[model samples]
Every structure is written in C-alpha cells, then in structure tokens.
Target: MPIRYFIKQWLMPPGLLLLLLLGAWWLRKRRPRLALACFVAGLGGFWLMSLPLVVEQVARQLETEPPLSVQAWSGLAGRADAIVVLGAGRERGDLAWGGQDQPTGTALERMRFAAQLAKASGLPVLTSGGLHYGTPPSEARLMADRLRDDFGVVVKWQEEGSRTTWENAQMSAAVLQPLGIRRVVVVTQAWHMQRSRWSFEQAGFEVVPGPVGFLGQDHGRPFAGLLPDNRAIWQSGQLLNEVAGLVGYRLFY
Candidate 1:
C-alpha cells in the first residue's frame, strides 16, 4: 500500500487534526514568538480548510448525481451482467470484533443494495474485498454469507487481494472476465460513485454507477447545509485522493 493510503486510512481526518492541534500548541508554548505565528497560521489554515460549509458545498456540486440519461441506474440494473458492490462502511459487529472480515456501515449498505438489485434483475452479484489486516474472513466472504443467509442469494465472491479502490477495479476485472461478464452495475456511496466508475472504466470494464448514501441536498436547515462537518472534510480528502489516483492511472496504467 502507498504511504498516502496508510495515512488516510489509519490516521483519519479527526485524528490528524488533533495531532496538528497538539503540534501547534507545543510550538506556541515553546517558541512563544516567531514559531507561534507560524503555528497559529497553520492551525487557522487547517480549520478553514476543514470548514464543513466549504467542503460540503463543493462536494454537493462536484458529486452531483449523474444525469438520468447517464445513470439510468434502474434501467442499467436490469441489463447488467453482474451487480458489483464495492466495499466502504462496516457492520457494527465487525467493528466490535476488530475483524476486517465483517461488513460495517456503508459496506453493509452496498451489499444490501446490490443484493436487492441482483434479486430484482436476476443478475449474479459479485462482492469484492480481501483480508484486510489479518481478518478471519475477507470482506467478500462476509458479504457473500450475508447474501446467502439474509437474502437467500448466492453471490459469486471476488476475494481480491486489493486494499484500495484502484485494486478493487483491477482485481474485479481479472476475476469477472473469465466468467464472461462484460458490464456491471457498480454499487458504492454517492460521493464515491464517480471515481469508482472512472477507475472501473479505465480498467476496461463497462460500468453503470449505482450510488447510495449520497451526502447531497438532504432535508436540513440552511445553517446545517452551511455548517462545517468534519466528515465532509474527510470525504473531500478521499475524493481528492481518488481524483489523483485517476490521473495517475490514466498516465501510468
């Protein structure tokens, strides 16, 4: 895994912010003069950069749902060769166990959505993910088990040895090609759909983005919409990472 990925996954935005705040406080106390100004500026910049209002507004605009003609998610779901659920959130049980194998949060949501789409369309479902940090079962296996037990759906498992979005596409393509799969309905969070679609397309797969859990235009007060959210800041960083990865993939892969 890349160093950047490690930082983003392990440190998290809030953790990193806390670290920065601590470092700034130390500098302010120690130097008490020139360094204090620098530390204060850095702290101010961090706050401004992470301000929820700015990030959320930009994300809302940039991550808008694809047009009906392009998305046509329901229509595409009906025609897809496979419903591919990309991993994200984790299940509560998984978190409690500290096992990477379980589906948490958005991961469960993606699986459920994919299962529904598969059941409705009669398309096979492909769950992707691998052993993250020595988890007992890979994410794929966990999601597959849920499909079988909860939905009575038999899904094909793509236990990809991937730890990132790029790997997910690359490994999934390798696994799906042999099964004569051409097009897939890719399921993931709304903020993640565009980059996921772009990566899969770059990997030579025809993808119809099936986005869920979007963070845009919710029923909230005007202040809520403008308020700075730490989650939004983290999401923006993830999006920026994806955009960078896309550019790198286009140039190198």
Candidate 2:
C-alpha cells in the first residue's frame, strides 16, 4: 500500500478511533479523567460514522450539481462537445471474469450513466484513470474495455496516466486540448461532482455536470436511518475523504 494511503487511513476514521480506544485502555488507571475523555471521543466518532444521516449531510453539501434528464442527455451534443466519464477504479483480476481486470462497482455505475449519455447524445467519449498499485492494466483501459464491450460505445480518448482528480483533469487536457474539445459533459458520482468540476474547469473545460449515484436519502426506518450500520460507515468514509479533498484543493489550487 502507498504511504499516503496509510497516512490517510490513520488520520481518518476507524483507525483514529481505534488509536483513541487503545489510549483509553492503556491509561484507564493512570489517568482516569483523560482515559474517559479518550474513550468518549473514540466511541462518539465511531457512532457518528455509523449513521446514514451523517453520510447524507456530507454528500448533500458537495452533490450540488443537478441531475440531467433523459431528454436533456440527448440534447447534450448541441451544447457540449463530448462525454467525459471519470474513472473510479478497476476490480483487479477476479475469478468470475477468468482473472481479467474489470471496472469496479463505482466505475460501473459511472459507465452505466455515461453509456446512456453517450448513446443519447451520439458523442465520442473519454475515459480517464491510470495504474493501480503499480499494476499494468490502467483504469482507463478497464473503463474503455467495459464501455466498448458492455455498452457498445467507443472511447475516443484514453487518459491512462492520471491517478488523482487533479491529474485526471491535467492529463485529460493534454489529450483533449489539441483536439479542440473544450466543452465536455463531465460524468461522475454526485458526491464527487464538486471537486471533479473544479479540477476539470481548471483544466479549461466548460463542464456540463452529469452526476450519478446520489448518496443522500431517507432509509425509511427510524433506527435504521440513524443507527450504526456497516454500509453507512463506508459512505461516511468516502464523504469525509471528498470533504478533505475539497478543502485541500481550495487551499492549494
């Protein structure tokens, strides 16, 4: 794993909470008051992460991009030059596909939406992502293959050297700028649209947000909506990461 990944995991949720719990255990008797404080803070953080409302609120803030109707999708080509499906990740070789790399679930979600947008608009597409953990098959390759094979849409551009959102925009610019494709229909998850839009705009594309997989929702059950759920924990983690990225992007860029 990368050092940055480790640093992020340790500094963020679960890991940080675990460290607090360990501190509380080690100093329970030696420092009773401090131990109690650590225990409370650790458990409190965990509880907050486990709630669906927490995920909803964080995602809602960043998912400011409005949804595009099917009617509007077909009209995109009139306003936008092409479709840009931002790569999420690859599933790394799986036994089901005979050990071939496949698009991750998140990647598939983006592909599914992009497929519709492309089919409706009849526009060329671009898939952006790079290698993972130093692996060969780039994320762009995986997305391109899936888009062609599964969706029957040819990807005109494959940006295979970008690892971050910032790089995605910068590297995509290298491929798109020369072609005079400045107006793009940017596709990604609704929660990530903010940073994605900022990065793409910085790269000089007039962004037409095509946000999919909205996260904010009401679970319908009172306890299930607010209680400790494993899925909510993951959503919370993703939302927290996006929030951090937004702040970092604003500060640095």
Q: Considering every candidate listed, which one attains the maximal lDDT?
A: 2
Residue range 166-247, candidate 2, lDDT tens digits:
9999998899989999999999999999999999999899999999999875656467577678988888888888998999
In model 1, the runs with Cα more than 4 Å from the true position are 1-12, 29-52, 61-74, 89-101, 226-252
Each candidate structure's TM-score, on Cα atoms with residue i matched to residue i, is 0.76, 0.96
lDDT of 1 by residue, 1-253 (tens): 4676567663544455556566667777677775566566657646654655655565575465553243343465556788888766344344555743457767877877777777667788888777655454677777888788877889866655766677788899888877888798888877777778888887788887788766555546357545556666666666555555556666876
The whole-model lDDT of each prediction reads: 0.69, 0.90
- Model 2, residue 203: what's the lDDT? 89
